[model samples]
Target: MEEESQIVFILFAGAFLAALMATFVVAMVILHRQRQVQNKQKMEQLQLEHERTLLNIENEIQQETMSHIGRELHDNIGQLLSLSKLYLGSSKPEKQAEGRELITKVISEVRGLSKTLNLDWVESISIREFAKQQLDRIQATGFCQTELDQEGDPWELEKNQKLVFIRVIQECLNNAIKHASPNHVSIQIIKNESGRKIIIKDDGKGFDTTIPSKGSGMTNLKKRMETIGGEFLIHSSLGNGTEIKLLLPN
Candidate 1:
């Protein structure tokens, strides 16, 4: 009976160990599942934040465009209309040629604005084509000469990614106009299996990279690229020029 009791104790110990091991495995599985759900939630949250940033940037660009339109109206088109009216009302016989010239100029300005300056609609276009149009607008100012080139197979990006790209390029163009005062701006898009790279170069009065500007928008530019899973790089000197590079992941 003592021997039988010893065998029973051994069996009990083995069963207890098996039960403990099973409990440990079940706990580990539950922990792993919880961690996976938490990770997925965090990823979703990050994507939402990035999307918000891109939308904000796009809104800012649209607002800036409206401001440009306002300036053109107040300074150029408005003034031209006023001058045309004054010329038309003149009773002096010698002012016929001048009046005709002013009227012609007014017609030309209206046609250009109606046919060309429309920049609001961008539903079906690719970002590359959109970028080309923006650079063309910059060049149309006559103060800047711009060139755009594309290489390799074009790729499509997510909507948020496209918006971020458009806004970033818009910002770069504005900065080159305002700060660098570049005479010639060159944009190139290079694509590969890995990803796409956009290079925007300007032959302008470049600034010293080491010196900090009070309110330069470089911070926003960097943040914009980071939100889109890309990279932004700038190279410039006091006299040489400025070159901006953006890289998108594969």
Candidate 2:
């Protein structure tokens, strides 16, 4: 009887152990599935944020282009039209010829401006070319001297990525001009097997690095770079100059 009792107890213990083991396995599977769902959600959220950021950038670019067009129409085209009207009013053929020439120039400028009305320019222009154009515009301002240096062949970046870089670089230059009152601004592009680096340096009244920024510009820029698997680094100090480095992987 005791032997039978002992056998029955052993069987019950074994059954309980088996049940525990089964429960553990099921729990582990459920936990793994839960984690997978959480991870997937996180990834989808990141992707959505990235898309929104890109869209915002494109919109900002469009707005800037429109502002530029408005300025051109007011400052340049308006002046040219007024001058042409004056010349065309003249009785002399020479004045009329000059007026016609000015009209032709106005037409060409309009066509060029029309081309930039769309966002296609974002895809059409290379990073190097865009940088050069920005620098040229700055130099035209006569507020600061500008230079661009390329060490190696330009790397072909995705249109979206290139657009981000352009916006960021433009922002940096703008900040230097608007806030730093930089005397000289320089942009250097270096590409190699490892990666690409764009360094923007300015001789300006730099701010202290330890001081917190008054705006969200720096944070936004850092997030923008992180979204694209790149980095934005800034260095500055009072009485010294400012430098921004944009690093991108191959």
Candidate 3:
């Protein structure tokens, strides 16, 4: 009878151990599933945050572009139109005819500028080709003798990056024309160790870049460069020429 009792005890112990092992296995499975779920949630959250950041950056760039375009239209183009109208309303017939012709020319220019302001240009043109065209246009304006140089084989940049580059260059050109009155401008695009580099230099009357109150255009250019994970450095003085170096990472 004691032997039977011992056997019965052993059986019960074995059963208990089996049950415990089963429970451990079940707990491990549950924990693994929960970990996988948590990991997936974290990944999803990261992706969403990345997307939101991109959208915000894009919106900011768009706002800046529109603001600049609006200012150009309202301040420059609008003033020109108004002046032409004033001239048209003059009593002299010769003045009226001259005003009408000037109005026509101004309208044509506005249309051209408006077309450029559209984002379609960014989508349609290759960056290399676009850069070349812009350089030509700047030279045609007779504001400066512009030169473009490319070091490596041309590679297409991301859309937003291209736009940022174009706008920054445009701002620089405009500043050179308006403030520096440069006779010669040189633009160079070269492949650096990590990515791309742009250097724009002009033989013009430079300014004290140490002062923070230079202009909104320069500030805006810096911000645009930062947005694209780039760096901008300006070197200038009172009589010396100005040079701008912009670096963009791969």
Candidate 4:
């Protein structure tokens, strides 16, 4: 009878051990599944965020383009139309001569505006030189003093990428002038194995980034950078200066 009891006890112990091991295996499987689900969720979230950023950027670009068109229409086209009307209505010889001169001036202005709006030459121009021209124009406006620096042999980047960089820099300059009230702005472009680097710094009053304003300009800039597989970093604090850095792969 004792021998029988010992055998039964051993059998029960073995069964218990088996059950314990099975439970452990099941638990590990559950944990692994949960981890996978969490990672998937994180990936989906990131994708959604990226899409939203892109949409915002496209909207901003459209808005900017429309704004430029409107300005040109109002300032150049409207003036020309007005002058043409004046010349047509005038009956006096002296007034007709004045109208003719005015028309000539309007024609010249239209030609200049056309040149400004043309994008055909962008492909032929170097980005560094283009940036320098932009800076010179901005300085001529007397809003702010701007400077540009470059390092390394400038690569021929995609046209859209070049335009995006130009727009982002222009946006930064505009922000510094209107909001930051900066006296000076500096831009630096560099190329390395990692990619193209753009740095825009301004000595102006900066705002808290944690409470970022949903400015169209900023949103568009972030979107453009993301679309190009680039990254942007903004460093600023209230009463301090602002620095924006962008990195784009070669």
Best by TM-score: 2
Error of 2 at 206 (Å): 0.7
Deviation of model 1 at 211, angstroms: 8.0
User: Is 2 or 3 the stronger prediction by TM-score?
Assistant: 2
Q: What is the TM-score of each predicted model, taking all chains together?
A: 0.72, 0.97, 0.55, 0.65
Clashes of each: 0, 0, 0, 0
Best by lDDT: 2
Better of 1 and 3 by lDDT: 1
lDDT of 2 at 164: 84
Residue-by-residue lDDT tens digits, candidate 2, 1-250 = 9999999999999999999999999999999999999999999999999999999988888999999999999999999999999999999999999999999999999999999999888888888899999999999979889999999896788987987898899789888988898889999999998899999999899999899988999899889888899999999999788999999988
Candidate 4: 10-residue stretch with minimal lDDT: 53-62
RMSD (Cα, Å) of model 4? 5.8
- Clash pairs (backbone) in predicted model 3: none
Compose the digit string of candidate 3's lDDT tens values, residues 57-152: 556546666876788789777887888898899999998998898789887877777765656657777656766776787887676788888898
Q: Candidate 1: misplaced stretches above 4 Å?
A: 87-120, 124-145, 153-158, 178-183, 203-219, 236-240
Better of 1 and 4 by lDDT: 1
Q: How accurate is candidate 2 locally (lDDT)?
A: 0.92
> Relative to the unseen true structure, what is the Cα RMSD of model 3?
7.4
- Write one digit per residue (lDDT tens) for candidate 1, span 104-166: 887887665554344444445687798888888887778788898999987687767777788
Q: Which is superior by TM-score, 1 or 2? A: 2
